[model samples]
Target: MQLPLPPSPMALPLSGRFPAPFLPPSMRKAGLLHPIASASLSPTIKDETIDWVEATSNFFEKDTRPIMLFDGVCNLCNGGVRFVRANDRNRRIRLEALQSDAGKKLLRRSGRAPDDISSVVLVEKDRSYIKSEAVLRIMEYLELPFPQLALFLQFVPLFVRNIVYDNIADNRYTLFGRSESCEI
Candidate 1:
């Protein structure tokens, strides 16, 4: 006999669209649409807390591109990367799948537990940010009103913000599906 498939996860209501200020004119004209690919820059984490600062410092010495560390196998993460790439004006971001060696090195340096890879990370200079904070920081650097949203998120309570972010992250695979290979 065949086993039944697991129930699909529930989807949260599509909350209001990102404020008009955040949407690019082209995207606004086209209406809300999911992006296929995007770019993201890593956040700056404090250097003093990380152990492998030397490695990171060496890697970044010659590279000026902003690095983005994300869950390589997550479809939702890949989509976000694509959206950022589309909106980036100066092309400042660089993508790095968290599963890659570079990503692992970055994580080790930051003193974060290995399992913390589940969240998106942004590494810049000697600083880093994770979860909702990372998301807000990234939006701030993007073109247009998206940066405005980051400013608004600052007023939100950390616990409340993280709770919502966690729910979406935990159920992302069920809602958006996943890929066998990393998106790169």
Candidate 2:
């Protein structure tokens, strides 16, 4: 007989409250999370508590370049990734599709649900950034004008920036279309 899958540790509790902020037991045991600064850093699971910053640090090895995780099937996201790859002469940033195994793992390791692909995720320097911040950070690695433009845009308030970002993100599939499969 086929065996049933175990319930996910991330499932909502019986009380109907939101799930706790902690790595799923499977993830915690798999050692997917690595501390950037110390070899001895380990999660304390007392009462299922977790140190989010420590848990999310250095998901990829320190030697690897910054990773930009995008929606694989979204045309706009794919285009954005291609543009970054073409413009990043030094290859300072690495791109991963949210549909990829590595991307899903990184997302989970960063305390986000793997299926929550609404925002682009930028993981760099032992930290994860999302939405407008992630886009702005990615610009820093692109050639000319973009870095300067990103710096200038940073002067805008975060709420206002995110409002624009969220509108684009929410309607990207309708605007730029989507691929039947991941483009790259």
Task: Say which candidate scores most in lDDT.
Answer: 2
lDDT of 2 by residue, 1-184 (tens): 3333433432222221113334446655995442331233323322235444445455444656878899999999988988998899998898889889878766655546667799898876555678888899899889998999999999998889889999999999999999988867
Candidate 1 per-residue C-alpha lDDT over 1-184 given as tens digits, one digit per residue, 9 for 90 to 100: 3333322111111121111123445665886432321121113322133446665677679786657788888899989988888888787777788888888776655444344567787777656667887788788779988888789888998778889989999998999988888876
- The candidate 2 region of ten consecutive residues with least summed lDDT is 10-19
lDDT, candidate 1, at 115: 43
The CA lDDT at 93 in model 1 is 75
TM-score for each predicted model, relative to the true structure? 0.69, 0.68
lDDT of 2: 0.71
Q: Cα lDDT for residue 35, model 1? A: 34
Please report how far candidate 1 places residue 21 from its true position, in Å. 39
Per-candidate clashes, comma-separated? 22, 0
| Model 1's TM-score against the true structure | 0.69
